[model samples]
Target: MTTTSSPLTQDELKAMVGQAALRYIAPGDIVGVGTGSTVNKFIDALATIKDQVRAAVSSSEASTARLQAIGIPVLDANAVEQLSVYVDGADEIDGHGYMIKGGGAALTREKIVAALAQRFVCIADESKRVATLGQFPLPVEVIPMAAQQIARRFAALGGQATLRLKDGQPLVTDNGQHILDVHGLRITDPLAFESAVNQWPGVVTVGVFAHQKASVCLLGTASGVETLTY
Candidate 1:
């Protein structure tokens, strides 16, 4: 990866990487699109090439609307057997490409879409890269009845889990489940932690993307976009 001399603003960097992601697309391919602001930039860029790809499989309803609004077709994930690439942003991505996502409360769907893709291409500003995971709170979608029980499980693991709130009430996910954002964790073994948490009864999906880790990352820097291949 190389850097440019002149520095660019954060939004400029995001747009730069967003536009750069277009190179990964192949004509007539079905793309797996993710959610978030950085990804929103990618979605806008995708509109310019809407006719190139057959259709998009979005991770959230919001993204589906955006794609349809731009005249790009959106397909149900069940209809697509596999995708050429899944482009999404990470809340925190480590050296190994493992990430903590779901900051947008779309973790469950994001993971589902990611599972249907052959490649996971993570797009992010440089700030999202980290030496280790877990500085950002880990989001876990849980069955409502087990919210408190799940929180206690995190406490036993030395982390604090709190129900995510919006409008002074529990924020419900698209799956009609509640989210528990766990804090105070330093995830050295993301795969193991993810496996363990997922085994808990109430857990629908854990924010850790170890199994569906990124194959490549387009990191936006002050200078330009840096490509990292894992």
Candidate 2:
């Protein structure tokens, strides 16, 4: 008889890292939660310890609903002066801890929540780890009227900027903005690039998280979870 063991799926790896992130949460502290599939798993894990944390400030409306559904109180980021930690997943993460996020169109709020946290703990499957940033299209939230203008600006920088759409219509973010996904970028100096793009008129937030890079990254691999410190 031949027997085979199935390999662990990416979602399973995500769940592992998501559960590992729970240790970073301290009792009685308000946590900042980011948006994404991996974060969804984190929310499920958080539910198991919902009574320990005071509340959570969610980066997206979806996350707010999920947290509420699981009996976790969701607070406004403005009301919270500081969070013990911010847990989020990345589209791509480099060795230096810089990441390209916003694949879920929640970059703006995610950045806000990240800025308010003492520690930013990134949780992701090992596939997200990269030696360089930018394999995934970089998401840039822009003012609707400035979409074309911003695309031109990105084009000048040698990036192919495309407007994100949903259901055959332009996708609108929770903040009522448009997203420009810029392809063909391999960011070497994330901090500088983020600053430059941010200065562009009508640009809301660039996907690069160099300024508020992760303090620690929990990478789930087939072997186990790997802890990487920035």
Candidate 3:
């Protein structure tokens, strides 16, 4: 009789990659944590070895609460000069490690934390890998006053921008800003696109993580975990 194994669910894949990411952590090193469900998995995994690391610098309040709940010490970003590694999840990661993040509306903070890290390790399921970015709506954090103007800017770029709402009101970021989710953009050159959008007034963050691209990616697959290095 022949038997087959059950397929790995998305959560299982996430957990696998999350656990895989632990190898990158060293004792006495401060880990930089990002926001999102996938990163939540990494946080849970990190808690298992909480004593191995000194502390964590979180990119969002939600992640900070989760880290504290799991008994991992959370540090203020300003208090940390640098991090050993930033392990975060990407919404869409391309071949060159360029990513489109901010699905959780934590782009600005995430970018800040990523900037302070020596290396970035992206953890994600295989579904997140793409040939090119733009399938997933790009998130842009902007000041409230410039929200409409930024929307027009994206529209000029052949994309449709919509204000992200929560509970019938505009969602406010941790920075007290608004987010515009731009659709219909095929970002071929992420570095250039990110640089250009950032030059526009009212744009706090463009959600294109080119400057802080991942050095390594732990991609979860149905078979197991695949590690890719840029």
The candidate that achieves the highest TM-score relative to the unseen native structure: 3
Model 3 ranges with Cα > 4 A deviation? none
CA deviation > 4 Å runs, candidate 1 = 1-7
Decoy 1 TM-score against native? 0.96
List, residue by residue over 131-179, the lDDT tens digit for candidate 1: 9999999999999999999999889888999999999999988889999
**Between candidates 1 and 3, the TM-score winner:** 3
Could you tell me every candidate's TM-score relative to the true structure? 0.96, 0.98, 0.99
Q: What does the lDDT come to for candidate 2? A: 0.95
Residue lDDT tens for model 3, 30-131:
999999999999999998999888899999999999999988889999999989899999999999999999999999999999999999999999999999
Model 3, poorest ten-residue lDDT window? 220-229
The regions of model 2 sitting more than 4 angstroms off are 1-4
Reference-based lDDT, each prediction: 0.93, 0.95, 0.96
